[model samples]
Target: MYGLEQYLLSMIYHYRYWGLFTVLSFGMIGVPVPDEFIMAFSGFQTSIGHMNFVKTLFFASLGSFVGMNLSYWIGRSLGIPFLHRIAPFLHMNENKIRRAEGWFQRFGDRLIVIGYFFPGFRHFVAYFSGMSELNYARYTILSGIGALLWSTTFITLGNLLGTHWQGIIALLHRYLSRGGIILALFVGIIYLYTSNRNKAKTHEE
Candidate 1:
């Protein structure tokens, strides 16, 4: 993963749009790739005259929409039972699934728009939304808006930063990676803590 990030960073320094699009597409489709960093670095590249902001944003959004739709279709076709078989490996739990389903039920469709900004929630929300049999047209609309917003925001940031964009991106990559590791550790700790608590409570009962 680290090597890939370095490779991407190098690519962004050269072919900004291609690098950004590739990273975002793969990342959205559940690859352990750094999509955010790619956007930020692409923005940095723009500052240095290697990229166009509008084009970068367009391609980034397009890639995200395509990748997410693919995942949605997979989940929709395979259904929940198949998803359950792969859930553990993906760190998806029943509680998370239920929560996503609940969100879909309440929102009817808005979750797709909102979910785009929320990491860890975005990918599964699409799948669960599909499983809920959300209208394809509506899903497309909401997801498209979300993708547009996310892509525009990051790419614009890159454009604005310009030359110093690389430094900013490097710092962000370090922090984002650290943050992901911390989040993973936190989830593990919470799972263990809850399990121990439940066992104790069960004994008392």
Candidate 2:
């Protein structure tokens, strides 16, 4: 992974603009790429006069919007059949799907905004939002706000921390590396608790 990071960093150094766009787009599509790192790198690059902050933010946000929409369309078109096919390997059950759907329905548009901050749920929310056929205008509005917030935060962090950027980059990388593990544990706990509650309800029934 370190080598991959180095390689990507090198690419960013050489092909800066396109590299940033490609990385951001792919990351939003559920690819295991360090999108945040690219944004931060762009920030550092901008600080050093290699790139422009406004352009970097625009491209990053555009890529995110495109990638998210693609995921949303895929979920809308594929629906439950696609999910069921992948469920066994993922160990996801119908109850979990139902629960997620319920939650999405209850929260509605708010989920899209918050989901952007949640690594595991980001891609899923896009699709779920589509499945729910959420208002396109509302989804776009909420999602755009999310994209702006997330992109600006990291990019600005990179710009402000320019010279000492390495430290912040290291901190971010550590957080990203462990983020999925933490989310997995949280999801597991939620699933187990929900499952037990469901079982008890069934027994009562």
Candidate 3:
């Protein structure tokens, strides 16, 4: 996981869209990959004429959506019985699952969408949503919207920052463990604000 940037850059340099999709899919599956950095770096590549912007966004969103749903299905199919059987080995228990369920209840469906922005949260959101028996329709809608907002933010940052993305990403990586949720919230706000502005412009036009 450490010193991954060099390898990620190389993969992006070679595989392009396929590389983007593969990395993010696994990252969301709990692999220790720098997903944000990958998207941002892809954006940087797009800005420099090394990749296509629309494709980057498309694949990034697609990879995340697929990965998240996969996690959800695993939880759903595996169900509680399986987890309970394995819990002791994994150091998880019914108590912990119930506690997480409480948080989900308080937050409700919003977690599906917002979870994408918060790194580790996304994986848990999908898995728990399934374990909690959340409706597939609601899960898809919330998760899709969240994935779009999350992917576009970092991708746009990459494009806008261009050559300077690495410095910003380096700074972000340093603070991510502490400020991840805060940063996710900030990005979500930006996404909402941008969407509103665009809607207003369309209305005016």
Candidates' TM-scores? Answer: 0.70, 0.78, 0.78
Count of steric clashes across candidates, in order? 2, 0, 0
Q: Which model, 2 or 3, shows the larger lDDT?
A: 3
Q: Report the Cα lDDT for residue 95, model 2.
A: 73
Which parts of model 2 have CA positions greater than 4 angstroms off? 92-96, 176-205
Positional deviation of residue 71's Cα in model 2 after best superposition, in angstroms: 1.6
What stretches of model 3 exceed 4 Å from their correct place? 86-106, 180-205
lDDT of 3 at 25: 85
**Candidate whose lDDT is highest:** 3
Compose the digit string of candidate 2's lDDT tens values, residues 1-205. Answer: 6777788878877887777777777788788777777778788889999988998888878778777888777777887667778878978788776765655565656657656665666887788788766777888888888888878877888999998777887787677557756764665576567667877999999
Candidate 1, residue 36: the lDDT equals: 68
Model 3 lDDT per residue over 56-163, tens place: 999999888888888888888987777688889978778665644554554547767756766676777788777777788888888788878889999999999988
72 Cα displacement, candidate 2 (Å): 1.4
TM-score of model 1 (CA atoms):
0.70
Which candidate number maximizes TM-score?
A: 2
Per-residue alpha-carbon lDDT of candidate 1 for residues 37-90, written as tens digits (9 for 90 to 100) = 678777666667677778888888988898788777876897767767887998
| lDDT for position 56 in model 3 | 94
